[model samples]
Target: MREPLFLIGNVNVDLVMGPQEPWPQPGTEVIVPESEFRVGGAAGNTALALDVLGVDYRLIASRGDDMLGRWLAEPFGARAEAWTVAEGATTVSVGIGHPDGERTFFTTTGHLHSFKLSDVLSQLEEAGDGRVALLVGPFVIPALLADYDELIAILRRRGYRVALDTGWPDGGWTAQVRTRVAAWVGHCQHVLVNDIEARGMTGADTVEAAAAIIRPLMPDGASLVIKCGPDGALAWRGNEHVAVPAPKVDVVDTIGAGDTFSAGYFASLVESSDLARAVTNGVTVASLAVSTRPRRYR
Candidate 1:
């Protein structure tokens, strides 16, 4: 049987559209060839990817008590039983995809701020049953973010290995942001970030240098991995680095590529017990996700 796993963080609606060549000007409308509405957010995207990969995990997240919230929850089925419904509109992200697979997003905070430590603890029915809990989108969830240290301590006490993947902050990686992230990183056994985030968080130009800077701040046995889009991913663990190359494919969408990669990496790690294999699985899964129109996660 697969090990007990938990995916905790934001869950929201996503309106994806585009391929517009140039940035649109104010008061002008630019029509795109394609558009899609789907579940998104760091944990939301990961949950969807895990489902496609046939991985079992308990999802602990929140949604607003609105129509889109109801619409978003339908995709998770029974796994969303413990999800909290906050008294507000669901967070929605409008992702505009570029021709090169890069994308930009416009988002609303909505109900994400309603998730708290109590909700997380309450939903952990089988705490400590196995190992591995992924925490994502830290900045967006103020209630949970405020008690992040306490949350990690509780999870650690419950014998769950914590993995962190905080998506980019709205204000970018400022000094205060880096300092706060550093504090949290110390408690996590796994820290995953994309290439840009890695560099920005550490002020290091290269991923290797960034890992070098970040590893010292975390605990002794912690691992750090950087997702490098089409080039692939790299992981630093146990004083060594592992490189995983991504397979090339025609691009389709890149909105949740990082989130999907996180799911695949950890899932493969739990199953295979190999860092290289895990990173390989991550990039492979992400490549598949971005190359397909409907977005295949397997």
Candidate 2:
């Protein structure tokens, strides 16, 4: 039987510049560019990818009682068993980029600021009787991290395996956060990290070097995936490693590419529990995502 997957994270509105030049310095006026608002966020993007892969999964996250929130929620209502609209506005991210897809982000916390771990626990408790796997990352509320140890303990006790994606470290990473989350990774079954995140964790300059640094740190059963965009992705299990190139395709927006790959990998796991196949699926999906016009969330 296919196991049920659960994604817990942020859901936000994305404002993307259609055609923009380099950002001007403070007090320097820049030419206006086309823009569009769209549904995005790690939560929504991951869920959308899983949905597209025809996986049975539930997305648990907080949204606001505003238009952006509504737009984020509509797509998942059919598949989501329970979703909440907290008493605030949904988060928004302004992305400035060129036609070639190199971009920068300016974000506002908005409703995601109101997220509480208790709310997530309540939703999970309600989910009931199924193999629940969680794909977590850094874009989530800080409160979520604060409760992670407790949460992972509960999920493990409940017989659920956890997959972790330590999203980009902001304002630089400190030993304290790394120690706490590292301990948590020891308890996880899988970890999704890029060369950057791996380097942060182990202080290696390259992905291969970072992978070497990460290999011994992973728990007894954990698989650590090092995702290098376009170059390819490497899957590590114990002392073994395999590099799989991403499928060839025309480049577009890379936003949410990692999340989409996570979804595909997780979906493959739910279906077969075969690590190699899961990694291949991730590459396939990420290729599909990066080849599209502008941005493709799933």
Question: Which digits, one per residue and each the tens of the lDDT, describe model 2 over residues 1-298?
Answer: 2756777787788887755665578888676556667778777778778787888876778778887777777877764436666787788988887767777888887877777778787777543344656656554576676677887777777767677888876655588767776777777778888767888876678888877766666678578898888877889886566788877788767778888888888878877767788888898888888787654534
Q: Which candidate wins on TM-score? A: 1
Local distance difference test values of all predictions, in order? 0.86, 0.75
lDDT of 1 at 196: 91
lDDT of 1 by residue, 1-298 (tens): 2685788898898898888779989999888998998898888989988887878788998788999988989999998867888898999999888888778889888988788999888888546654788899888888898999898888888888888997788789999989988888998889999989999999998988998898988888788999999899999888678988888788888788999998888779767877888888999899999899788887
User: What 10-residue stretch in candidate 1 is worst by lDDT?
Assistant: 122-131
Give the TM-score of each candidate.
Answer: 0.94, 0.90
Candidate 1 regions exceeding 4 Å error are none
Candidate 2: global Cα-lDDT? 0.75
Residue pairs with colliding backbones in model 1 are none
